[model samples]
Target: MAAEMTVSELVRRARDGQARALGRLISLVEDGSPRLAEVAAELAPHTGGAQVVGLTGPPGVGKSTSTSALVKALRASGRRVGVLAVDPSSPFSGGALLGDRVRMQEHATDDGVFIRSMATRGHLGGLAWSTPQALRVLDAAGFDIVLIETVGVGQSEVDVVSLADTTLVLLAPGMGDGIQAAKAGILEVADVFVVNKADREGADQTVRELKYMISLGRREKGPSWRTPIVRTVAARSEGVDELVQAVTDHRDWLIEHGELDARRVQRAENEIQAVVAARLRAEMGELRGGATLAGLAREIVDGRSDPYRAAEQLLADLRS
Candidate 1:
């Protein structure tokens, strides 16, 4: 039924609050379907409505729990929320290993909440290859806030910074996250720092370390905004409201400092570059399978042409 549904019908139903239609649209994105361009075109006008918030950190910091807490908080405030939980892929089937619906069973029946788990599929930066397009589908579906929970692989989750309006770096006590965060170069990308499991022992010490790090690594010039630290015991829903408030404050600051539009522009630029690169890679694969690359290799093997010259010929073929 979904495959038979036209892109217009899907977009229309999605805008009319049809979850099935929204799911199908995102499925097209994830599978790299032939209709992806049509789906994107249909959803373009409705894009940029939802605020994209990204949560990333090392494993065992309770990111999933905190995301559920955040969904509850946002829903309580009468906001429709969508969550994209990027989970590790199952080696056999290449599907999401952890299903968020099991963890966040409370929100399963809520009409205003939509949760999806996307498998990383070994893509770097702790996100799936199609996350940006999935976010577009959710945004066009009219969710007020879209939360992206990255695969927590410690240092490499910083790609969320490019996509989110506000990026939260979650840490926990006894994780040595402060030093790890600095080493990962994620400290500079964080807009707000969340210290989850704040009730645990050594929580204050963790907070102090983060504060010291933040002070030392403050940006020289940009939005002139200060990153706020919020502590939370996500299991108990403690300090969640303050975290929400901090998110609100950051959004307001972005708008006030005219950084929101700038960020979105950069996001668009990156998306375009990604598409171009993907297309080029596909063409290069075709070249490798065809006689062109084989002939070039034979020439290089026979000492008839150098590698650099053969590369130039390949570039010319690509241009043509």
Candidate 2:
């Protein structure tokens, strides 16, 4: 049997830059370990130092390539970066394909970078259920910047806005992505709008369409800030410096406008609410008979009891 380790050892080793230990801590979080509470309490003091930035968009928008480019740019400035690439889960085993990790192999030997791929496990909104806790592990491990790359789920992917201090929405030319973006409500969530693959033919037209859409005031994301449009050919590393600068500018703007603290507070609030909901779900599942839930549904379907009353009965059973 493997030796049991203490939370202190894990925390200390992870903070000292042991990538294996850090990965183990994140696994503990993902597995919902019994010692998770202890680990979280131990790491609480070390977190809140890293900047959490989320990159999200429709599928084929070059999020992974852009993330790798950003890592190269940020590391050039002497910052330690961590990447959380959330991928769609396999239906059979619920495991991630880890495609992003493979794409980011150039950084495999770089000690300053850590890349992890997580499975969404059928979770909608492009993020895994354990993602917030995993992010905490990265934050506590002393990463200067944490980039969360979500699965490409189109409109429902707005949950990243709640988790990230800054959200970058990427689009590409030749995809009719500008119109699709407006229809999908993607424009409202962007702190920086990146037009990746800018070498394509419709690049200028896409930029003009996005600018026109932004000017319509359909989504008022900032009262004092204008979300800047950035062009980048991430595969060639073209415009990456400008993209990174745009991200930096947005971070600075958040600090200046008092939105940083407010956003963090909101993130904590969301985490707390999600935890409570999950706990309640588990608690409700512990009712005396597992079939009681199905029985309740059957009763509702048979018109013997309405859904409102059936839900009340479930709560009553829980209280008892």
Candidate 3:
């Protein structure tokens, strides 16, 4: 804990390329400290520049491997990279279970790469509760690219798409993931389909199935930027450059079509809503001392008021 540094100092040092300062800032957000507003103020002007890319898929799809491969490619091109690997929280401890730094030890010594594994902490959709704020930290730190890898919690993990400019849905061969991916509603959100472990026997089948499935649907995006499927054996770092190139192409497309700003605006909107919701929850807890929501629940339970009416009364009270 960098407890000695004030919020302003942390923001200044982080923007100056101090990794420790940036790490502390992210921790502050994860812990939901009151100083978060100050941190946000410091970061607001510097954000929305980093290209956020989201990678998600079923378990065993090699999302971490692909992320590491992409980091290598990005670093080789002199781009500073930030990787956020969201891992499941331990039930008792609330700590990240799978330490992503271990898998990405290859970049451990690279000053150009910063990787952090965040605990999902019972948050659903395979994202950390503090992911948006943590991303703002990385963006304000002047990273050229940010790679977000989800907790691999199956289909409901599309929340990453809201925050990323380009979302990669990865599938491994022979896992029945192709059908599951479609069932998970992942087919619609993927800007890029990554077939990992491409050297495996079912790789061609996976790619073919995805292409066929993609052909059956029409994108609402105007001007026709067809999503590309990139094949990679991430363990060997093969096809990573092509994947990176595909991401670059998508970023360029977003910029040209003015979708980048649109996405960022949506991202900020989501963040603000989350903040307001959390604050309301805190306020509701305080109101518990006065039997507000509890009183409403009792009224509903005793048949004195319907749930909808009780909810309306609670909203009226909150506004008052």
lDDT of each: 0.82, 0.82, 0.81
The runs of at least 3 residues in candidate 3 whose Cα sits more than 4 Å from the true structure, single-residue gaps closed, are 88-101, 122-129, 152-156, 288-290, 301-304
- Measured by TM-score, the strongest candidate is 2
Give the clash count for each candidate. Answer: 0, 0, 0
Kindly list the per-residue Cα lDDT of model 2 for residues 111-217, writing each as its tens digit. Answer: 89998887754322224347888899999999999999875455335665568999998889987655566676667788899999999999999899889977888
lDDT of 1: 0.82
The Cα error of candidate 2 at residue 215, in Å, is 0.6
User: Of models 1 and 3, which has the larger TM-score?
Assistant: 3
lDDT of 3 by residue, 74-170 (tens): 9999999998877653445644534654654677678788888777554322243488889999999999999988854543356655688998988
Quality of model 3 by C-alpha lDDT: 0.81
Which residue pairs in model 3 clash with each other?
none
* TM-score for each predicted model, relative to the true structure: 0.90, 0.93, 0.91
Please say which candidate is ahead in lDDT: 1 or 3.
Answer: 1
Once fitted onto the true fold, the runs of candidate 2 whose alpha carbons sit more than 4 angstroms away are 1-3, 88-97, 121-128, 154-156
